[model samples]
Target: MGVQKEKLVQVPRIENGIGLMAGFDIRVIQEFADESLRATSQDDIVEKFRKESRQFGFDYFVALSLCDLADPPEDVVWVDQSPKGWDQIYIKNDFQNVDPYFAAAVKQRLPFVWSDCLDRVQRSKGVAQPTHDMLDEAASFGYGDGISIPMLIPGTHRGCVSLTGERPDLSQGPRHTIHLMAIYLFEACLRINKSALREWKAKEFIALTDREKHTLQLLGSGLNASDISEVLKVSEPTVRYYIKNAKQKLGANNVTHAVAKAMLYGHIEI
Candidate 1:
């Protein structure tokens, strides 16, 4: 088996003055497939999405690790392909106090509208941000009027696709159509990622022993070899021996590779 690069489909543009204002930026990043399988480079994939986003009129574009879910300020645009001189302060701070819509979408594995979130705000108060600062920022960026779609692959990771604009009333118009287009685009990207992962796993050969598997499980939870040895009640040398054996068995070049393979094979969870 070899690595396969899944093709992504182009999403249609939404019909509205504001909907047309912000463009669709799509990126699919597969680090495991890229490094292990040597299928596609991260830089090449990012550039492809960047070009698509520009052609579609997206104001910003980014491809990141879905598992990290770090809550950074919105104004601190991690992707430089955005409009400059905007209200960076408010954008950066707005999502700080609220439950990230992207996070919610990923967890639920479904497409969600901003309206669905706002309507359910009362129930989502705890998980969602409820700061006046967020509201003020929303007003500034017109974020209240947008759509969010979650992209998830079974037995894999999750991603989010969001489209925002200044349009306040997206109930029944071009804004809704644009949101639909974005959803289709996100779905295509998700399929591509899924296919790539499957292909990469097929070509990769990594195995682990029972003892090494247990050790890796502990290590994934931020445990050192000494700590793992203490919990397992095994000698430090025994633990090292198991790790070495597992590394050789899995064809891992190092300890980190061994751990990664263990996790991928369900021998360890991260």
Candidate 2:
């Protein structure tokens, strides 16, 4: 059996974001950010994020950095604490394309809660699908309430951190404080990852999202972007996005260059 998640200690809820903004221990937050930024690897960065996030009443969190805009990858560069079963079903169904929160995060440059997105979906005309299904599926895994904080990394990529579980006593202030923390955590993630970046020059390995990996595999099998789009059931633009994003991450000049680097790094066989 999996270990049970710990309940958060109660804190007084203050309105208008005053309590968290004015009273949150900025010192401790800065300290964690400093430590995380100094971390040596991706694993270390995730450990720091998990530890710090839980202190803010987040039961579980998943951090993501989207590398491409046209055809964004789901579940990319993320650290998740959800149950294995939940994740298994998610991957099996390719739900990332339809994940309401992810879709919102990619477009909006703001912080929002899961319910906020759900309501927007409900209020819109000709909505893509049911808002209840999205929230209900999450609740099935014990995630009834949650928040998603999205960030735009200057000159690099867009990232987000999603927290879920038993609703903590978060007021306006506390929520804002956590939002700032996500930025710091993402900075640290990039820092550590940069040092270990799998560049064509260095021949080191870099992390790729599951979608990116699959795309690479398909390309290795002599598939073009159009063919890959049909195979993945995604748009052709998305296939291009995956290819370009992989190319950039591998520090290659083009698709062929990226594939060669991937082979050199043993990420795929051709």
Per-residue lDDT of candidate 1, residues 1-270 (tens digit): 338565576776765654332322222223322322442443444454444333333434333224433553222212223234333653455453354554466566555666577567557654333544565555564444555555554554555556554443344433444444444444444445556566456345444556778887787787888998999999989888888888877677988887787766656778
RMSD of 2: 17.0
Segments of candidate 1 deviating more than 4 angstroms: 1-65, 69-97, 123-129, 168-184, 187-270
Predicted structure 1, TM vs. truth: 0.38
Scored by CA lDDT, what does every candidate get? 0.53, 0.72
Best by lDDT: 2
Q: List the residue pairs that clash in candidate 2.
A: 17-172, 17-173
RMSD in angstroms between candidate 1 and the native structure over all alpha carbons:
14.8
